[model samples]
Target: MLTSDTDAYYSPGHVAQVVAQTVERSRLKSVIDSHCGRGALLDAVEKSFPKIHCAGIDLDGNAISHLRKIRPHWTLVRGDSLAWTAWERIHRKLGGSVDVAVLNPPFSMGQVKGVNIELEGRVLRGSLAMAHVITTIYHSNPTRVVAVLPESTMFSEMDRQGRAELERLYDVEVVAQFKSSTFRGARANSLLVGMTRRKRQRAASSVEKAHYMSLHNAIVRGGLPCFEAVSLRHGVPFVHSTDIKDLVRGEAKESLRTVRPFTRGIVNGHMILLPRVGVPNKANIGAWFTEDDVQLSDCVIALQYRSERIAHAAAVNLRRDYEALASLYRGTGARYVTVGRLSEWLTNARNTRTYAQL
Candidate 1:
């Protein structure tokens, strides 16, 4: 079956066989494949769990129609796996949430620089795939869940919220981690994860849930203004990556150049200049603190805070978490991270286990 291709990958028959065996070992009586594609997993599932009742949900009508004909005993529905209504239909058919959920959720979501997915009033931002697994855990309330996800799903800055929530709600166990070429014609690093719901814990209003809930409102974007227009003399003083050589070299910063400010008046307070584009490494990762109200070029990210101590603390925190933050920038090209991801990273670095965690 052709995949949705946005971020979803249809698990091959053999791959599904492996994942199904893992679920079968859990001895679950009922299972739901939230992103079931053409019933590949379901096919292997039938053999793996003969007595278990199975249900599958997918956005593809043809796949659901095809399954209805081929697997008459199975309950298959054509609708979004992310929508509440879709799950409602599945719940009605199954008599309640299933024992376990099998998932091959969408990954990366490369099209959007940032992603936000909310369920049951809790929101997860960053990776669409993480949101899928986390949401399934929330909506299904199943005892166990097994999913095929990107290897970075547990660590990436973009999926931090999902990871945090999962850790909070489940006893996570890694079923398997696969090579980038594990799936034919697919190059993403993948993994199989199994999670069992914890005993009736306190609700999300607990201390940890309050912290996780606070991250949903992390100021991801628009915190720092980008300025590109520049001139030799007339406009406000501006700093570029090249100008920060001495600062990086443990030398005093020289006079900065000038650029047109994006704001109407003088840019106020202490500013932080960060290199937005570069390869991922320690030399490339830094927290360049600046004291000018000057405009900064687009090449560098300019930020401000109400207090100088806060700005200094932020810079120190970013540098402290440099290695983890650098992971956010991946691939062979001149990698870059968006302001939103960076903001989320900084926020996570300080309070929660998302990065630094006291």
Candidate 2:
């Protein structure tokens, strides 16, 4: 039910709350919302802290006009947030640096033509415009930046390259995820992620500290046990989750794949761990590994459960590690479910001809 006609759309109130929290924690002096559709978040900031100087920018002239009527004193600019050249010029004119920048940019979709291709052919792809906007703003020396984005930005392996590039330039500190329903009519789950310049290690450090605190609280309240009881050890290369395909076909050593190395210093017992690679939300996509897969060095193990009996057994056997892993999964929802049953389902489905290939 919640939607915006502006180019920089208005996010849900929860997103505004997260932005407010980030700003308060950073003790920022100035604030700007790059894609400030309708200025809902900017209004929230103004109402809560009247003295803070806030600005809103949007390409839509009508949206800017409406915002000006609502907050006559606040500065609102009409411009494209993604235009790096224009942004650089504006930054120089605005006395160099800003304290915080928040945004909810358009999720553009389209195709491009290239050489060595047919005239009618096109490749499907997600837009990098919004990501580029954030990157550009960060380069402008903003101390803190927060944006509301689709969950795919965090979970999809398809965007790994872009995500890695962004991470290299700016440290992504916290990701507070919410379901699609939380946004009323949004198509995908949304997340409020905070980014800061790598040069400001203090800001990154504080954000990380807050992230752990929030994660711990969610784990404690989500009915999941803490991970302190379960044991974690480095998995063997050959037997790692990635190498499962190789090991199953008799292409690798089975001895190297066992849990021996992981349980070496601690008490010997069975534990549930996930493969280091592959997508995180395997349950939603029904993608997983089987017993016959090859073992790769990137694999790691944690406590797992399928039926209630299995969960109980795993909990009892690896009480410490189970709690630790569960804490990690608390706020993440089904994206972090145990790998045992899901892996079996994925392997079986992959083996079946009727199932569509990923």
Candidate 3:
């Protein structure tokens, strides 16, 4: 049985070697593995940098006992790595110089078995284990930090907030994203990021802005009108994803039929829509908005914006960048834009620059 009690999925030996090789380039005297499961990472670091002192922390007692017996010389401690006491102990034993910290935190949400780790001189909130791990290590003021995190952490609202807090304490150097397959059984993609503490102050205008999150936490509510709700009466205009490009180019024909005044799929002027599904060679990835209220068919997804101005702006910019938007299409023959993935992609798009300028 290839199973372990710790959420500690041991890193493949080759992967551990890669981390060791990457760290070898930097000038460092001490290294800490916040969640060192079975010493997979520590072993590689020791083989490559024989002189560098190492420390390992883990919540699993079995893992700690196993590692301690195998590598008796290491400073292996069994405790919540996010705890202030753990950090203080590690820092003291390493002569107050934690040069580099390698972390592969548990990919979990919520408190770890109701354990609260002290952070920023106080008990940390939230159950996001990755956030806690990074925070604890960063607060220790290591010279360099390398962490493996979920890809959604780059764009998800909650993870973005965690990243924001991290930036307030350090400067991120690289965010290398890799496919989900990089880690076995990983449902989402992951990011191997490197960051260091910010050393100086800068003018407010010179600061690099965080990614615009207009669509990051945007709610995607959709509806498909029933036969009765969609009629040729004096109600609301009916729209489709196929009409989005034409509508943006000001070449769309008037909707032939109208839906009920308060139809289920009816959306106000301040809303965007993409096909719930799209076909190949179809320009269906763009967003659409109009000053007129409209109802959509079941095949469309309606994203309501906070205001009409934002919706119109997003539509225009999305049109100008149609090629990029089209690239979001998924599936083989009957392809479509995935709402969740599209939302993440939109946050990193230049079209959302309006939010950044603000």
Candidate 2 lDDT, tens digit per residue, 116-216?
A: 11111432223343354444465456766777765545433234334444454466754565555665444555567787767734443555344322221
Model 3 residue 274 lDDT score: 69
For model 2, state the Cα shift of residue 23 in Å. 2.4
* Cα TM-score of candidate 1: 0.60
Error (Å) of candidate 1 at residue 9 is: 3.1
What's the lDDT of the predicted structure labeled candidate 3?
0.60
Tens-digit lDDT string for candidate 3 (1-358): 0123345556667667767766644456778888898888878888888887789988888999998898888998888765667767776777665777777777755333223344546653333554555655654567667776665454443343355556655666444555556666555556677777667633323332332223323434344444445475676676655656565455543643566654235554445566667742334433455656666666666655555566666656656666776788777777777655665566454534742222
**Candidate 2, residue 358: lDDT:** 13
Scored by Cα lDDT, where does model 2 land? 0.46
* Tens-digit lDDT string for candidate 1 (1-358): 2133644457877788888877745466788888887877767777877888889988878778988998899888888877888888888888767887888876655455446668666666757777678767777788878888876675444565566677677767667766667766678777788887778654555735543333332221112244435465666665555554545445544465566555322333444455566533355333344455555444555444434455556557656767776776654677776654555454442544432221
Candidate 3, poorest ten consecutive residues by summed lDDT: 208-217
Candidate 1, pairs of clashing residues: 238-257
What C-alpha RMSD separates each model from the true structure?
A: 9.0, 14.3, 9.1
The list of candidate 1 runs beyond 4 A from truth reads 1-8, 24-26, 108-110, 200-358
Error of 2 at 266 (Å): 36
